[model samples]
Target: MAESTPGFELPLLLFAGFRSIVDQLHAELARQGHPDVRPAHGFAMQAIGRDGATASELGRRLGVSKQAAGKTADRLAALGYAVRVDDPADARRKVIRLTPHGYDVLARSAAVFEELRTAWAERLGEERLRQLEADLRTMAPPSGFRLDVAGWFGA
Candidate 1:
């Protein structure tokens, strides 16, 4: 066989690239004054955006247990990024919603992600990055197929 790329295998390269992206994401969050934010919370953050939902609902959406989602919500509450309030239609149940701070963080993080994507576009031409993104989406492994905590987070 002719020589292949003299570097890591494809799967290993993909994994390393993903890890690097997540690392950059966390660094951006911290640099934006969200030191308490974490990769784990990224799931909770998306799940609890805008109108928000019950902890149970969040758990279901994230494919995590209700207890795990509750704990994450608790952490967000403690950080002043989220608040648990009585559900309007059902006082017995609580809903987690993003605080003003949380909304700001969300907006800022979106900009950070754009910056990261732009950097990638610079490395590989914008058109190439667009094709790569489409290819990744088309070839992405099934969500249920993931076995790591990172699986809880979305693309």
Candidate 2:
């Protein structure tokens, strides 16, 4: 990634592994009847906390433009997972909140994550898995990294 030799390295390998894990997790969730939600969608969901968040706020949190965040909000609304309502405090502003179904998706995804972790441990030794997790946490976490359900399923 730096000005160096053009070959495989730790960063690339880590990215590939991250992508693989996310892809597999999505596939497993699909098998268990979760909707066609991608990791990026989880970002919007997370930004829009239970108290709700404006599209501007989501854009700030996601490091994207307001329009981009609005687009994501539009997609969530179209998917019946989110709704944009006028802020009670400020009638001119809009905030996004998850639908009951969206909450269900989050809950189900959490369960599937546990299931996947269990399966991985069963296949590749629980102690090794634990060490791997711990080692990752040991590495300096990048900016905006939160150890939450949605953080595990990152954008």
How many clashes (backbone N, Cα, C below 3 Å) per candidate? 0, 0
Cα lDDT listed for each candidate: 0.82, 0.79
- Leading candidate by lDDT: 1
**Each candidate: RMSD:** 3.9, 5.2
lDDT of 2 by residue, 1-155 (tens): 66875567877988887777778778876777765788887767877878878988887777777887899899999988799999999999998999997887778777877887888899889999999888887895655365243334345
lDDT of each residue in 57-134, candidate 1, tens digit only = 888767787887888899999998899999999999999999998887888878888999999999999999999988
For this target, which candidate reaches the highest TM-score against the unseen true structure? 1
TM-score of each: 0.84, 0.82
Question: What range of 10 consecutive residues in model 2 has the weakest lDDT sum?
Answer: 144-153
Error of 2 at 69 (Å): 0.0
Clashing pairs in 2: none
TM-score of 2: 0.82
lDDT of 1: 0.82
